[model samples]
Target: MPEMLIDYYKAIENSSAKMLEAARLKDWDEVVRCEGACAVLIEQLRYQSQQQELEPAQRKEKARIMQRILRNDAQIRVLAEPWLTQFEHLFEGQLQVMH
Candidate 1:
């Protein structure tokens, strides 16, 4: 069978879930990997959307999936904030050392 637009939404949601899980585990590398997957999926989705569109029911499901993805992304940001801050500080130190 051919692929569907809803399937892309589901795959993106799944990737976001994985990203949240990896973030919770403090595995930033895995989170980054999942993020890359999400990015590729998003691009694929954009391309596929031009060719296919969801039915009314599928559109509803897509909305719900998007909500969940947003939730997962919010949680991931919350989990990664401290680490990002520290990473920024590390870069700052490097810049200082270079000067």
Candidate 2:
């Protein structure tokens, strides 16, 4: 809602896209870097979520935190889904090879 929150969401979305691209390319190093960035953002979001009282100034900060969390989650799922899919494909290929 707040501009700050919108910024965080944008950052998360960008980072997630990078991570997904890295995974899709099988670039483990890039994936790790993206994952680390996501972890830091997630921590910041968790801290903001714990604050009980938010002032008007803090509203943007809180919104940014929430956005970061949501985007991070979506990014993680994106990264994981491809990995799972790839693994299944590889496993099936191995099975066929064995046969």
Candidate 3:
């Protein structure tokens, strides 16, 4: 059971890593695709979590995996900031023309 939980976390970490790579490459579409995959994994993890508990050692490992996932997410957000700003500007311009 603990191993299964760890596997889920590992899969999420892999998805996050892929997302980070896509961000680094400036491939927003690929990043979004990986984000969707991560979301599904997260949902599955949530359901599995309610049905099982991790042992102490596995808990520590899970914490480490979560930390890496968070770091990847943070970097992805940073990479996205400029693109988001540009998208917002485009929307603002459209709004002004429509008014």
Residue 45, candidate 2: alpha-carbon lDDT: 54
Model 1: lowest-lDDT 10 consecutive positions: 1-10
Positional deviation of residue 43's Cα in model 2 after best superposition, in angstroms? 1.2
lDDT per prediction? 0.93, 0.67, 0.93
Model 2 agreement with the true structure over 50-95: per-residue lDDT tens digits:
6544567657765765675567557657767877788799899789
Clashing residue pairs in candidate 2 are 5-64
Give the Å shift of residue 81 in candidate 3: 0.6
Off by over 4 Å in 2: 1-3, 49-99
For candidate 2, the lDDT comes to 0.67
Give per-residue CA lDDT, model 1, range 1-99, as digits (tens): 128889999999999999999999999999999999988998999999999979999989999999999999999999999999999998997899899
**Candidate 3: regions farther than 4 A off:** 1-3, 96-99
lDDT of 3 by residue, 1-99 (tens): 224888999999999999999999999999999999988988989999998989999999999999999999999999999999999998997899899
